[model samples]
Target: MARNIYITSIEGHAGKSTVALGLLYTLSREAKRVGVFRPVARTSNERDYVLEMLLAHDAVDLSYDKAVGVGYDDVHADPEAALSRIIERFKAVEAQCDVVVIVGSDYTDVGSPTELSFNARVAANLGAPVLLVLGGQSGAGVNRTPEDLVQVYTIAHQELDAAHAHLVGVIVNRSDPDHLPQIIEAVSATAGADTPVWAIPEDPFLIAPSLASLLDAVDGELLKGDSELLLREALGVVVAGMTMENVLTRLIEGSVVVVAGDRSDVLLATLMAHASETFPSLAGIILNGGFELVPQIERLIDGLDLSLPVIRTSFGTYDTARIITQTRGRLAADSPRKFDTALALFEQHVDSEVLLQRLDLNPPLVVTPLMFEYGLLDRARQQPQHIVLPEGGDDRILRASSTLLRRGVARLTILGDEGEVRGRAAELGLDISGATILSPFNEELRERFATEYVRLRAHKGMTMEHARDTVTDVSYFGTMMVHLGLADGMVSGAAHTTAHTIRPSFEIIKTKPEVSIVSSVFLMCLEDRVLVYGDCAVNPDPDAAQLADIAISSAATAAQFGIEQRIAMLSYSTGSSGSGADVDKVRAATALVVERRPDLAVDGPIQYDAAVDAAVGKSKMPDSEVAGRATVFIFPDLNTGNNTYKAVQRSAGAIAIGPVLQGLRKPINDLSRGALVQDIVNTVAITAIQAQGVAADSAAAASLAASTTTAAAAGEQS
Candidate 1:
């Protein structure tokens, strides 16, 4: 039977999702088949942000419906059936996984006086060990003493203990860091020294509402500035009723200044403050009273390029202030920063190894495709890189750019006519305002880029005139932007040929120093796993040495994307079973790979079936580790690789996320000519990740673990 652990909190906004996400991540590192289940939901149509985050992070494989239980309405209508449905769904998840992380209900809906009781009943029925989370601050604010935390935990423990559910631990979440030690000491002393008690310090970024959240709370309308700015965390809320000097003194970074719409002086002062470095940056300015700004002030605000979000609400200043204060922070799907921060906090505070030992969960290694993609997005957002999309005229490109900006994936520079792009965006109802739109044909940029291009290709006898004409092309211009350090990487080919897209890059950016040839790999996201198919879209027919290089490069790409590297060099024959030109080439390549990269687990002259099918692989090469469990497959030629990827994509119903080109000095990815919006988005994200120069070094992983351990140790000391 799969080990089951239920995560429940005493009340809403108790940071239950943080605990669940942290547990899922921790368990996923060891568990091959980890599943998540939410026993009850607030609404039927309400999207489960926890489940979405898990899926996005590649922590769990269960679908939303199976992972989440019946809606509150259905449960209210028929309690018994709802419990049965939840149990049935949970069992389905449990049967498929080594461990199941079940989440209890949030007190989202009204008239739920027995939410805790309901959770306890479900925990008892599931016979799962429960990890109760309690809000450390309590109802008053962050003034809760150590005794207050212990009291809350004691009450929760008594309730779960009475329900006959095993209480494995208690997590005191959103606690003041300054008092974390006292709280933990108290909880341990009172609840029992042997019992596990973890205190997670409150993170302002996690608890603070974004400008958009505040806007929604007040039902405000966006009056000026970029909507993308609304995603900024509102760290402070200030009502601008006082004098300008008083407001300035009180302002902090990420402060939301609430003022009446007619308060032009306050509005102008706030904008100027944001403009000046003397004062902290303003997150946004909220205009209350529904009073329209005077024409001159409105024009002045519009003419200036303000990065701060400005919103207008119908409510008066005090009411708006009250609403902003009362609005609870939520973990939106787009907020990767908060998710990462939460995960980091959990990892720092909780000892996952101890938790797993208590839960009696021992899972094996299983890498799912979703997990791979999630890692890609996570790494990309860790340090956002600048990416340029040259084919901004295309609606798909525009849409992808908007999505990237909204998700905080990358800073984008879309190469096109600003007016035309904006017009197209308006027609499509796309928000590309966050993106920097640059005209490739702009005289000044064209001249500057031409001069740089001439200098770069001057050895080839290229003149300024020829350079000027070349730089006019969006591809050349975009590539030049990367070359000039204006952008980190570029993604094009939506309306251009492969040669046209890669030509400028090859000319200007060039390949890495160690790489003799450039190759491409399609991250074949199959039903169960993510496999790397190498040289799929680049080299037509690589020599033995080139093939070996491709294998090494492909392995690095796999590791960069969080795919463990076990390379299989594909041919028509397995081992020394056959003697042919193709087999000989693969055998030579395999030898070179072994010679060059001895640390890499690579085997070659292997047939496709033997590479993938365990039974066939064992029959052919019984002692080979890379044969059956190959996560990276190296094809002999482009024809074979391209055909195989397309066939598997169509026949197996796979979602192939790449043909992600590798071995450039800087990242420059090409998209399929017929690529959809999501494809572009994924490609752009991949490009941004690649630009970060993450390598395939186990030392890097070791270093990260060391840092996490160090942080945990520091926290313990504190």
Candidate 2:
């Protein structure tokens, strides 16, 4: 991959952060060691919000001290010295990263029309490609025609050419969606087919300032309500002056309501509307006019459990409204909703993958957690399997579903009441319209599932009536969907126990013919590389055969994800160092793995340190190939495996992803009840990849059987 790229805008307020965020996320998927830098920037009083937002991503391992260089004033005072300093700082970041994203200055220093050229020169010096971003919102507002955008592109291209910077792509962000086709046609013809060109429509939600920005703009204080709601975006401003009936009717979703402090009628009505959910959900309430809350109003607001962000400003209603209208939105590290929306919009509009191909982002040198996670998503997306989420009631699931749908990662079927799921998603301002919402109560589906359940469990004395009721359980219904080919895989357990999520799989999906019992593994993502730990979530204490099976499956799982598997059977002893029943069990398991899969490289009766540490391995089992550098570790029991994985996860600061159930005839994985949205996304991606692997296995088996049949026919004819 091109290790460095510089993103610069043609003018101020060009939505460059939207373009930078998209490229950063795209680079994150392409490489694990991604870096973001700002060569020249305006140092804020508190912090750099854009750099902070980029650093907040897990894939970006950079500190503010390293990501930024001299200030705009410094660049203005001494251009040569400032460029040198910028190069020095950029090199420091580049030395540590495989690929870097260099975002241009914020253009906060007004009256300096040379800022764009300065940024281009910096990119040329750094040998980075330039991605020029144009402010389509300004153009669209002025009713600029398609030729206007093409003219903007021509000028930007000329500036970059003057600086000797390679132009890789062009993006017209904040453009009108209705005018995208004409703009793209004109720009693409000018940009040339070799250079990619895309247009991102202006999203009102993205451009709307957050409640935090509004509060700052009006110099306000929180009089009551949740402080967290300050992060919500204020899509519109409602200056309440009319009667309560008129004001309440005018209230809009995500709008900040500003009224005089004495307007208890409006306040009470807004509170009632918030409680009823029949009206629009507001961002918060802003009260001005310097009037203190009356005793009755204070008592009334205090009596309620309020969540609306209520702010008090010294300015009157009109002044507050004026200030709020002028406040533009910002992309801050704390605003996840904005980042999500920005990424979704960018992915929807930008052809970043094609641009990367032109830049030649080859495979990374080493496998990292970020790289592995991206691999799972990439594989799943290649085929786009239909994965089912059983826990539709969990907010995290729904949010992750929106992300998945937006990214086009997988086709999802959420098991729940259609109305309830739709209502919840709308209330949360989430767009999950792309997902398939299925309810367990659907009569036709329930009976078909119930009949299948009976066919699978008839020997267990399962009756039609009982099966019908049992299949109505979401977990069972979802698993049945996979079993009947309605879905490719299943991801659940955000609201249920591991057994509750996987029990239906055991009864219906069962294990592969070569496998006796199902097992699970945790892909421990360390800073540098990814390793596999097995039997950590399932099988409390597997005997020798089961342990061997876990080892074999864990290795295969690791290999399936592009991790090389040199097996290390962990124990309390290393070779002949000690003797005990536990060591002996591990030794026997090692022998079993060798007996079954001689193709695998394995070593057992080895201490944890020896299994991982090169020095310890040399001192203990110098002749063993798997004594050190083993990518997959098989734990003999759950007590040791679970505690060890958790300790490493917390102490070493690793990301533990899974309880990825293996050996299943079909793919079914479980999630921790405390799983975050990104965690759910990763798990679902893993489940989809596992589904791809299963299909491949079935296809291979069918091909082998057909060849055998043809050979038999040939022999009989002869």
Candidate 3:
């Protein structure tokens, strides 16, 4: 039952080590039996600390005959022997644990020596998921050339994928606070959002390992910092999980003495005695069974001068070692107060502010009402400010509301009836005593809606009863609330089409009067870059005028997000390379934009790469500002826009954000039919900001127009 998780790095010193340790430690806290394997090793000194910790903690379970340490010398001098030996050790360790953490070597590219590839092969052999680790260093975000990061990631991904390892996510460790925004943006732009990036903050505690601590804790050595041995962090060991023979070898050569707490004393003694030979500078021994220490074993350990730190836990040693292997330390950037330490740590490492901006707001822990129900919502409500429910008033939403309110996510609104709402809530496990419920049936508002309904109905010669009946549905009420500024926003469409959800808003709120067309834009965020893609959701076949409006709207959106506008009107053909209706559409759209907004920099009839890649743009249209370096792309139409955006999202491994509604009188946004809770929260926040900005701009523009009109009238009168 061991889940094999791989730990890799994009480049050297990105703190994959710390990430390995943290994940292992966290998993250990959850009581999962964990083991670890390293297919490659460079330094025996590093090996000593790593192995010693493994041995002392009973952190690993596999038994190996040969020593646990694999050296760079071994790799160069006897690579085949080293690889086979490491692989064998890994197989032994894997057998005894429920999960295995595969620690990656420093080789960032494909030409990984046999040792590294074998480690990946071992992960595949054990059928474990891979969690790639990347180190975080201050200024590394802007300092490291983009090419370097891309190359590193591309290689790491290639290796893991080639090994057929199921990469779960990435851990960006030692994340600096100030550079967080840039980093998150970069990673999102580079790696895509599907790959979760867990930013591990630097912990001073992990950095303060004394020489004595090193001797007693890990299986590593003084590389260059031997004089600062006391300052070293104990480098935990890697024990393979293939079989008993492999386990036995690790027991002997591994510096950290590890024995499954449940295993017989003879086995513990066996591993200890074996490890004592190669790793004479052994740190400590770990007992895995959560058992009381035997005095005789303790005396032997003390006499051996192998200072061991014994962690008493019920989890087996193999799993424990896997967890330990991932418990590397973090180093955050220097900060002198301004926030609570934990929050500061979160801000420094997680970069909450940058996360907020990159995510368009604070990330929400969201849950689905239909699937997870109260259980899911309860968990989500604990961390976020808003709770979004799917369109239905069921028992789950009400029950979850009590938890939501208690957790102070600020707002909890359901998607169903006022009449049956309380009953549904009561039917579920909801405590509605202190809950303030709002339903679609506000009598006063209902009456007011009836009046508006009658007028619209009168225009159509419909009766009062029919008019009242038509206005009673949740969609109508929800739409009215959004238009009337009663609620922040409403998400509908599980039982409705995009047109159905949007039609109600169009009827009530209408498009911005100045704007000829309302459109949608998709935000494409890759590793560290974000691109705005317009006409992706709306305007299936817009004319020149509509295209111009779409361009302006998209450019405005980019500006809102601090992206300098470089507009590219995309088509199937690049610069008339292919001529057809599609090419004509793009050409006309580009011309219309230039005519309407001469000041705006827009170019088109371009391919995807040409629009985004500088090299491609330079070759295709040397004189065009947007040809090779556009951040905002205006697709010819929704078919091409939607399809291309999705293709990029699926194929190129990009995160597609938004179908952010544009040219609306107010900010009314739409969510995906299968949107997560965080998606809802993020869309809402972005929409809110968009709405407020539009409102302010409208007021300013209107005032300016009025002033111009007055002056013109005065001149005419004179």
> Which candidate ranks first by TM-score, i.e. highest?
2
What digit string (tens of lDDT, one per residue) describes model 1 on residues 1-718? Answer: 8988999977777888888888887776666678888888768565877667666655466677778778888788988898898888888888998888888888777523267767887988988988988887766575568887777777777778777878888899988889888888889898786689899998877878878788888998998887876776777888889887887788876678998888788889888887765676677899999998899998898877675678999999789999999986777666544655676688669987799889886545455554555556557777888999998789789877766776577899998888778655643335577899988888998999999998989899999999999998999999999888889889999898888898888899988888888889999887567889998888999999999999999999988877889999999888988898888999999999999899999998998999899988899999999878888999999999999999999999778877788888888888889998778878888998888873323348789999999999999999
Q: Candidate 3: global Cα-lDDT?
A: 0.56
Alpha-carbon shift of residue 249 in model 2 (angstroms): 4.9
Which scores greater on lDDT, model 1 or model 2? 2
Model 3, 1-718: lDDT tens digits are: 4445666654555555555544443333222345666655546344333333333323344433232536556766876687677767766776676556566665433434343455556456656666666555533333343344445556677777787766666555655534555655666677786665555554433443233343333343221111322322333453333344555555422234455654445435543543343322332345555665567765664555432333344556566675555454333212101011223233324422332232222222221121122222322333332223335553333433443343333354565554456444422223344444555566786776667656644757867677566556766666666555555445555445677667666766678776888888887765445778888887888987788889998998888755679898887788867898768877888888888789888888888888888898899888888887788988877788888899988887666767788887766667676665445544544554564575567679999999999999999999
* lDDT by candidate, in order shown: 0.82, 0.86, 0.56
Local accuracy of candidate 2 as per-residue lDDT tens digits, 505-578: 99999999999879999999997789999989989999998999999999999988878899999998888778
Candidate 3 lDDT for residue 225:
14
The count of residue-pair clashes in candidate 1 stands at: 0
What would the TM-score be for candidate 3 when compared with the true structure?
0.45
Q: Could you say which candidate leads in lDDT? A: 2
For candidate 2, the 10 contiguous residues with the lowest summed lDDT are 137-146
**Candidate 2 overall lDDT versus native:** 0.86
Per-model TM-score, in order, reads 0.68, 0.88, 0.45
